[model samples]
Target: MKIFKERHFFRLVIVLLLVSMASCNKKKNSYTAVSELDKKTFASTQLIPDDHFLGDASCKTCHAKEHDYWQGSHHDKAMQVATDSTVLGNFNGIEYKSQGVKSRFYKEGSAYFVNTEGPDGKYHDYKIEYTFGVTPLQQYIVKFPNGRFQCLRTAWDTKKHKWFDLYPDFKVVHSEWLHWSRGGLNWNNMCADCHSTNVRKNYDEATHGYDTKYALINVNCEACHGPGKDHVEAARSLGKDYKGNGDLKMTSQTKPKALVDACARCHMRREQISEYYNFEGSMLDHYFPQLIVENVYYPDGQILDEDYVYGSFVQSKMYHNDVTCTNCHDPHSLKLKFEGNKLCAQCHVPETYDTPKHHFHPTGTESSKCINCHMAGRYYMGNDFRRDHSFRIPRPDQSLKYDTPNACVQCHKDKDNQWAWEAYVKLYGKPKHKHFSDLLAPGLRGEAGGLNHLLELAKDTIYPEIARASAVNVMTNYADPQVIDNLLHFLKDESPLVRGASLDVLGEINAADYVNYLLPLLEDEKRSVRVKAFFALGSLDEALIPEPYKAVYKKVKKEFETNLKVTSDFVGGKVKQGNYYLKQGKLLDAIASYEAALEIDNTNNIARTNLANLYYRNGDFANAEQAFKTIITQEPEYGQTYYSYGLLLAELNRVEDAIVQMELAIKYMPDNIRPYYNLSLLYDKANQLNKAESTALKGFKKSPQDESMLYILAYIYSKNNEVEKAKNIAKRLVDLYPNNSNYRAFYNQLNAVQ
Candidate 1:
């Protein structure tokens, strides 16, 4: 395997207790004792059965100040009916065109409508059911059949007061995934959970329709605080001096992590484990936060995707020191507590970070602003720019080596990384950041002890848990026994992210020997941990599971089924469903699942890829070839299709064709070693001795301990009359694997030849 930390729960629990004590002292007169008040409304994490969501209007009576501040905030305007007052776009029969799509915005009898390309590849009038978001841009929603609400690819630039295409560069046909009418634009699946309060996506698996409901049409007081009926009733019945809050989660009453976790429920690129927000347990219980991985994040841990904030925030010194969303942003208004450098000066000394000597730029300039340097951001949703919350200092040195973006180069686009480095060092001295970037950048390339270097990063407690989890995620590339052993140590890791990640990698490698080691996690305190355990072990043969573990497995299997159900609408989820079926010897079911996924979106290459793989497995080589060909036609650059097609060709003894396909695979997936290894054998089979030696040697440079590559290289050298070179390699093979009789024979044979 080119594959694969510390518990922080106790420390957090202590912090929570201390913060709770301090909270009571901080608001002694207004609220009752935290314990006394909480007992009646909350039984552990669950609210009383009678409790219901009391809408935002009910909250205004008691929290007038908060309500006033929140009235026009992003949360309040997140979603709304397309009425004249609520709609921000100039929908006056204006036609906007992009990517061969001509969309017209207009109104018909007090109803907002868009004459745009829909699912049928023809123009149709779609009534704008709702407007999504408010500032920089606003997307219109059109309710389609099967209870699907699709967000329009045509959006209004609220600031520029003009219409624009979200993806201007690409041509989208009706059959493609990114088409406005497809599942990619689905509001019920992607947008609703975050935008509304108390949302329940009642999706029918059989019908493929949704009966989505929300207590509030937009994010409101109860959205973050949970259902407010308990709080409202308690305040009304128990009076101002009452000991407890009505079991409603007030951000003011909670500690920083709790408050941040509440906000992170929506403000994260997380995997949804449950259908609705339950207002229970830790953030991990409700959602699994995205680990900092390639594509999503740069090697230096800067945001490269729409990570929301929690993924980046958790990796920051601020989050490590218990700073939270409300520390900089007002909980109610969702605006900065202070403008410019003042916000940073809340903890940092103003003279140290805010002065010209430190920043080296003129005051009030974009370069001089603290956020411009420390919180480098990129535009998302076309124009809505979101800064990274990791609070890292600019490291142009890393940028020079790693190609990661730095604030210095972001503003001074004309300047190269060298210029940025020189300027930075001249002002601030050599940057001494002890963060994991140094370890991670090279680790990603698997250079200089590769997986070992990553293991060191994962084990080192100084790095954030999210970073550690990312290290675990990347370990999938390296599949070594030693790496698997090192990874097993994390099964009992303190953080759920770390623990869940351990299960994920172990399952990927199919470390069946460690399945016993993973059973305890099935009963873990966190829902994410338990869910991961089920996912890892769910497809196993029942005989592999010990009798002692069966009862727990039986219980978790139900949760596992629910897990499948909740995500069945997703292409990734369907891929997972197919895998489970394949593992359980249910071939037809697996094929059906993958085929159904393609029905949802024909452009879903993963589903199509899985179908091709199944076809190959079932001796339907012609069908498999056709499937791979179709995929290559649809996505010419997709490397996996070429690699898979090469394997099928090799299996069918089409060596010349296989060689061509494998060479293409190497071209597209350069980092993947399997292609190089396979191509080397193909050359040897064709009696191309020099080409075989060259290919195997190149692959050996990447994975030095690869036995097969080494053996092939030795055989090629020996055949080509390079006896001394062959002997040297044979000696290494014997030294590395002394127990292998073939290696011993090869070494002796080489010695006799020399």
Candidate 2:
């Protein structure tokens, strides 16, 4: 119960947010039909002109050599119709089983099909519509009603020549989000745009369905080179002597930034800000790249989860020094331009870097391999081992200090971090430069002086924009007046990534106060930035805005909704839509969106959490109670549930039950101040004077800045006849909130009692 009562872990719970949320009105379980909701995927094949696209066959006549390299590359085979030539998986009536689920693959005439559990939780014979990905492992896609394409969890290991479950350790039930039949596995919203050329996710809001369309079923010539119609027309009319440039300005000689942007459109793990990728602007103009953050990357920004190359590559000095994709890999073939140290020799001095004096290992060994030391990779998609493009020094010293992954220990599995650190020092000596990881690792961990260090990193343009953006994002975790000012100031930063990241933080914490500062960004050049601005000002009162800015606001709001519509087919999208509706006071719409999210996958507790909160707000406590109970059973360790349930119990006058829940909440959500603040009040209600006073004192010690908890402590002190203690707290409250008449009145009352 007295968790966080000692020293600060630096994980500050921003006050009792639940207490404010409980005051919201509650209603009966009335959900809007998914079709009836205004949300849409807004994906349409008609948005762009069909004539603009010239298929791969149209380019082969002039670019024969390049076309040959592209013909059977992973990009060319990224997606295809399920045919004898394209289908890689064994389909000779072979049975595959994993985690209580079983599936049988076989052929039905020319079509491939699998007998497996579907959305209905019963085994059905589903026809394979397409094959997704080609190397290492290949996934099969099955079509559902309303144009949905679901990737089966059971994938074919191309290397192994057998079927295996992608989620081997996971218990993938049909009703779960990660199930092959659920939204997480839906190809239209998740993987279609990247796999195919000119994909339109075309999700119809009225049907809860998809009409997903693509120009080509694979990543074609037009996918990276923009629409090839102009180039084709120019080439045909000009003949061999004609040297006129088509509007499509891409080649092997393309600059690092432009070329990287074209590839990163698909490669990077990002948020789409536009409905259709018309190949108009940079990647930032269409998609918001995810930053290096905890869980996805280590605190020091090495790959932990799937960063998809771009996020990691941008952090390297190679990218900053103007090395494009074509420098290391043949863009058309998607193969390494040179093997092993030869690739490093293309730019790096082979005589210097390729020697044992540098690597301290024998040549031709895996330990001496340049990539194994610098660009240590991780296995993804079960079997596809992809290298980290960051190309960093193997700093086992930093690994020892910050606990981040390093190639030294990564390869030397038998050795500890300490051993690696000592061996590295004996080889390279201590690093001279003050690495950003030294600052970022501690900052992300919430260690002392971390926030200030992060602020310095955010302001420094010398660091990678993505790294700076990460610094900008971390500022939101702390609460301070100075933090708000710093975030607002960062809104004008040159990097769109930093600017958008700052807008995200400002919009989240103080959107209303930032109306004037945020208005200019509604017309931001980058769509990702503009959309972030819209969401930040999402809770803003439109009527209060200046009339001159109203139309621009409306336009960005439309863009914002369009961005949301693109992802509306996923559970995360529905939850976002629900939040959008909730903010607009459309209670029924919010409830429907949440319900629809749950409908897609019943185990999405995030959707249920919002739904339960909505039910509690609407005064339909019965449904709220049930939803909370269901969530507890579904995910027992979710601390917010116990805390929220305790609030409802208090409202219901179940004092003893509420006390138990509050205590449990504190145990689970130790950093949170709400449970401690509320529990003190509950203890007083139960007439446990000693416990009430002690708990109040501990809570006060934990968060001296929280006035509400301080007020509770003052009340508890007064109730226990400690008038002087109560008077002192009341006086301090008056000083902190000088003009508050409530504090003044309470202080006078305490003084009189004293």
lDDT of each: 0.76, 0.78
- The sequence of per-residue lDDT tens digits that candidate 1 reaches over residues 673-714 is 889889988898888878888988888898788788788788
| Candidate 2 TM-score over all chains jointly | 0.87
Per-residue lDDT of 1-754 in model 2, one digit per residue for the tens?
0001001110100000000001012211112122211213111111444566778888898889999999999999999899999998899999988888889999989999999999879999999998988888899999999999889888999988999877688686667666778766778777787888777778887787999887888988877776665556656666786464534545766788778876787777776677766644456656787787787788888987776789999999989999988898888999999888998898889889898888989988988889998898887667778888888887887777778889988878999999998987887789888767777877788776788989989988999899999998887666667888888899999999999989868765657777889988876767678888888877778887788778778767777787777766666667767777766678988888888877766776766877988998888899988998998998888789899889989999999999998998888888788888899999999999899988888788888888888899999999999999899899899999999999899889877762
- Which is the leading candidate under TM-score? 1
How high a TM-score does candidate 1 get?
0.88
**Which candidate gets the maximum lDDT versus the true structure?**
2
Model 2 weakest lDDT span, ten residues long: 12-21
